[model samples]
Target chain A: MRLRIIKAYFLKEMIELIRTKMIMMPYLMPLLIVILFGYGIKMQVTGVRTLILDNDNSQISRKMILKFEHSKYFTTTVKNMSEKDALREIKKANIDAIIIIPSSFEKNSLKGIKTEIGVFIDASFPSRSTTISNYIQGVVMDLANDFNINSSGMININTRNLFNQALRDEEMIVPGLIGMVLLISPAILTALIIAKEKEEGTIFNFYSSPVSKGEFLVAKLSAIFFLVSIAIFVIFLVASYLFDLPFRGSFFLFWLASEFYVFTALGFGLLVSIIASSQIVAIIVTLMLTIIPAFMYSGMIMPISSMSGDAFITAHIYPVMYYNHIIYDTFLIGQGFNSPTNISYLLLLFGYGIVLFLLGLLFLKKEIK
Target chain B: MKIFITILLKELISFFRSFGLVILVIYFFTAEVYVAANGMEIEAKNVAVGVVDKSAGGMSKKILSNLHSPEFQTPKFYKSQKELSDAIYNKNIMVGMIFDEQFEKDYYKKLNPTINILIDSTTASQSLMAIGYIQNILMKFNNLELPVALKMHKLFNQNADTGLFMGVSELLSVITLLTTILTAIAFVKEKESGTWDIMLLMPVNPKIIILAKSLSQIIIIMIGVVLSVGLILFQSLDVPINGNLLHFFILTFFYVATTAGIGLFIAAVSKNIMQISQLSIVIMMPIIFLSGAWTPIYAMHPLLQYLSALSPLSYYIEGCESIFFRGTSFVDLLPYFGGVLILGVILYWYGFRKIGKLF
Candidate 1:
């Protein structure tokens, strides 16, 4: 438990980290993920390419095709290919959907009869196909209402989108990316430290020395935690500036919360490394334990509330879930820091950190014996 | 040929002796199967919304009543807009809606009265779909008369099984990642332990050694693929692979072969296991992103769509999806097979050349 020994170990780790460029590698990950997910990974489904085949070729059918063309969701074109060719292209995934207006479409609609419009969707990707189908339905309904306007009752519903008016995927994606990247980088950075030492036959130095396991673990954790926190702070600034992210919460509270989250993640990493016999096992285990859960159970992309039984239970146990919730709250919701629920979740996150570090200390002692 | 067989046997023995590698292989399969079965769903269902109705009129009531389950939970009534906003801020509800005082009056007068929706945009995709639901409910409430009926025919996946799509795509991605990583690790592990130089000193050709190593890795990866596809995806998850089974495996072989070449190239470049792991992420990220496994290529910018051609995964995902969903025959899948084959040959040549220099 010597302070001098711990500080020396901390400095040694810092020098190694700098020499290996490990510290610099993590910094790149957050930025790459932010830009890639922000610009490249578009969740909003738009510009779905659709082919419209018209058997009727009537003025009414042309009007229907025009409605689809005008939609923001669909980029529609009237392809004059035969049904077989259209099906081939659809199977080849050249087209997302095909709309066929029946031969008696105009006559039936003019006679005030219900006309069945055929919409064939390539449903390989379910969500996209569902969106395309929904868009088609909306357009068809709009056309139907237009035809029966004199006898129908239609109310224009003006919908107002609050907070994120544009609903930029970046706004939401950036914050979640911050949560995921911060957790994973710190955990992995700390995870390989002890395992690397053992693999290189350097652990015998510590075993022969007077530095206690607690002190050794603390020294390593603090160094990696410090590097990771600084990296996260820099990433936060870059994300805020680069993506124009709104920072409405108190900066101090956000920073404090981030520290606790990083400690918890690093502690988990230390725990994994302490038990792992080899660097490969440590890395693969850390990756599987942290990255998958961080992506899936942390509610980064999918809301925890929406998860079913097995996944929902898993989410509640992981510390990443609480951290992800805190990030979303502090970044987007901007509720005051003193809120009881917010405090409770943050406490739970700190609790996980303390428990994990203590567990790692206990295991290291047993391994020494 | 005797030297190749000897090298291949040694590689296989080392791989089998490592219990950690076996566990990791098992972990990858089971975890993917679990996530694909349970996760990969983004559809908003039973979303609880807070409502503030100032109008208290027939139209407002009708809209509220129309909100039903599988999409919306029973709406909780709020005393005022402040309460609704607080609930949303606290995450007690995903969304908050406020109906204006002139709701029914404006509707009858053909003056559009706005319904304000405050969404927690952190759940981005769900919020977007929630908007769709609100719009659809409004459309239903508005157009009570007969409209032109739309008959939707979902050609491939009729029920729109998201799990099936996610499971199958994940299977391919996992196979690609595992084969590449394990092969790279195997190559570097020997170098790190000082056995690579010994092997290099042998009279065996470097090409033979490389092929032997890749062959061992390919065999193991193929077994994992079969177990994942057969036990997990097809049987456990009930994902129907509609294509010819033989054609799919042939395509998978080419895909895995291309990755092995890429892995060998990485091994030649890296100095240690740590470096290999780091480089793996660097190499794998771009492939996964551009592969259209998670996001559709049609959704990407045209430039990205073109750039995706450089990644063999892009062809693999498309070809696999076509085979699984559309049941397209082998000859029709010539383009995908050729893409993987060409990339494999090029990378294999480059990697072998680099290894020759390393020795």
Candidate 2:
């Protein structure tokens, strides 16, 4: 009786998702996010923008101007421009910012007068604006030190992005891209499976058919499991070969962890689809259920522990915690976290995945009507 | 006016009928407020740090002891930069402090000895705070180095920059995006349930129906805003609004209108909630990523820098910072609001055409 009932629901779900346009259409979002982010994500701050309004006209001011002109971060867009022109340049955003050495800056410096060398920045673009401000602050401080009269001590920062020795964007983004795709694995399948059945009017047929519910559930979920595995394998190849993500760990271990993570994603996606009234609701609920918490708390970029207690707890509830661990170990670090603390995180996620799959089973049962 | 009021009431009833709607509201509030408090804000308070001192000398000891003590969140120590960097990558550590040898010698002779500080700039807000703390410590070092003749004028509030000041702005942006997205979800839900057709067959024009739906959603969105402001006030999560509260609300009004219009557009173009939701993610990704939430916008590609200008949330965040944190007046904010107004009008116009086709 139980097997027949489960199979009845399983076939019912599979038919509905296959027919639903709304549910099926979003298979594109994960793919698009992957392609775009693969190209976009980077850490190294480039295009350090600086505008020039040099009024000194003297050899010293001109020479100092040349030093500002050719730096990795600083790019001088304009010169010999009036204050109006400079302000106009700011409004037009002709530059990220402007560096104005007053007409008598050289004279004042030579005379040991504290003449202000005004560096006007376009604060509209906050990050670049802030970057422009910071780099200029450093360069101007260096110039002041060269004078030795009013020197502000320069502080140098050296960065070593630990696991990622190279600190390449590809390594950083490709893993995130893969996680993002896998995160959607179960969700897309779950979303479409039931909706297609509902749309195709095959849900009634499943109920009439003699197949046991257990066998039916097995078939419906097996199809999803197979598709999800393919998606994972595809992402792995892309991350490994196309994006050239660093793979120092055993591929088998990575594959093992990923299989476990995919099961969790599928279970959650199934649960989401079960609750939804239509394909649209299924997708939105699933995305929110998976993406928001994962993106925020899964310790992918932001440390979940840094957040408040409740938020921290919520992060663990999503599959991102385990899947992200798998990604980090496989892609960047080359091995799983050797410490028990790291291993515990993976175990905790595995436990949560089981719970989520159970929830999917229960919710699917409830939604059979 | 009476007809509009009736339609508005009707729409409100429908929105309330769906428990899903209220659940979404809760998600928006919880996620935006709580997440923003921890991650989105520019304010970093009581930052936890780890400090390592290999140099066993007196000056190094002083710096280490200072960092070791609870004054600066009692920084942790690792054997080397390698271990510390690994901690950062694994999210086990937030900041790393290393004091090189000859620390005092370089101070007196002006050798400009570098005090290396490693921070995870992924959470840009916290990283900035760590950077500020380092600055404060170093500034103290500088004061001891020089004879201390000149008193430098503090032109700006150095600590008040983005951390606490911009936290509210970031929260506002997040809340606004989620609200508009939720409202869009309702429209798509209507389509999926076949209620959209029923609305279309009514005596009212489809445009009026859309307006009524949007207007009802506006009320719901404002509830979220009120909740956020109330919580911020209670929690004191951000620096108090320095500029003007009334102006801040006024700015929120325009922002909501623009987002609502955009949501309406999305609802009309997309067939169902799932499609709209997916598309919404696509639209919101750049807005969130390039908005300087996690990483600094200046650090992004040039194309993204210019593209960020098109994001209404960007203007809203800067404006909120100006009013609430920076204490800038209405005239100072005209430029930001002007940009928002222009974008809102253009998006509204474009969305209107799209909605017409979809409806």
Residue-pair clash count for candidate 2: 39
Off by over 4 Å in 1: A145-158, A366-369, B53-69, B98-116, B138-140
Q: List TM-score per model, in order.
A: 0.94, 0.73
Please give the distance, in angstroms, between residue A129's alpha carbon in candidate 2 and its true position after superposition: 7.4
Query: Which candidate number has the best TM-score?
Result: 1
iRMS value of model 2? 6.8
10 residues in a row with least lDDT, candidate 2 chain A: A123-132
For each candidate, report its DockQ versus the true two-chain complex.
0.54, 0.17
Model 1 Cα shift for residue B301 (angstroms): 2.6
> Per-residue lDDT tens digits of candidate 2, residues A1-369?
466566555565546556554333334555667766676644445565666777777876776667777667676665676776666544443355666667786676676666666666654323334444556655655555555554434444554435555556566566766676777757666666666566646666666777554465566776666656666676777667877777876676667667777777777776666666565457657766666665656655455535556766776666676667667766666646564445676676677778876776655542247
TM-score of 2: 0.73
* lDDT tens digits by residue: candidate 1, A1-369: 789999999999889989988777568766777677666666777888899999899998998888988888888888788888888888777888999888898888788788887889999988877777778877886786676565334555445455456787777777777778877777877778888888887888888887888888889889888877788788788778888888766677678778998989888788888777677777888877877777778776777755657888998998888877777777776774856767888889889899988888877852354
